[model samples]
Target: GRQGSRSVPQIIDDWGDYGAGVGQVAASRMAYRYAWSTTLDLE
Candidate 1:
């Protein structure tokens, strides 16, 4: 979703709150998927 979790100060500066919100949502989704896949919890 995001272009890697790398910090893009320039983009944040350019896109402002809207860009930050999109990135935040994307990063959170990616993190959730990763944790779910890597864990061994059956439930």
Candidate 2:
């Protein structure tokens, strides 16, 4: 989640726009934290 956020600015710069994909990536990573916390195998 934090890593995704860190890359956001770089992604925005690379793509030359603040678009939906960046938001999706960050959101997905944030959600993954919950899953990882709940399951040892996935983690």
Candidate 3:
């Protein structure tokens, strides 16, 4: 599954509002890393 065009905010928004729990924080970190990696690959 390639989501290379999505920004971090867009990814988070897609996940919907799940409140700020530990899992949400971890997921955000993972999404941020995924987005960063995808951006690097695009370059």
**Top model number, TM-score:** 1
- Candidate 2, residues 1-43: lDDT per residue as tens digits? 5744656677667675556678888999988987887797665
Residue pairs whose backbone atoms clash in candidate 2: none
Worst 10 residues of 1 by lDDT: 1-10
Tens-digit lDDT track of model 3 for 1-43: 4755767897797666655566789999999999999999999
TM-scores of the candidates are: 0.55, 0.42, 0.53
Off-target runs (Cα >4 Å) in candidate 2 are 1-18, 40-43
Error of 1 at 26 (Å): 0.1
lDDT of 1 by residue, 1-43 (tens): 4766646796677689788889999999999998998785755
Candidates 2 and 3: which is better by lDDT? 3
lDDT of candidate model 1 versus the reference: 0.82
Pairs in clash, predicted candidate 1: none
Checking candidate 3 for backbone clashes, the offending pairs are none
* Per-residue error (Å), model 1, residue 16: 1.1
RMSD of each: 11.7, 12.9, 17.1
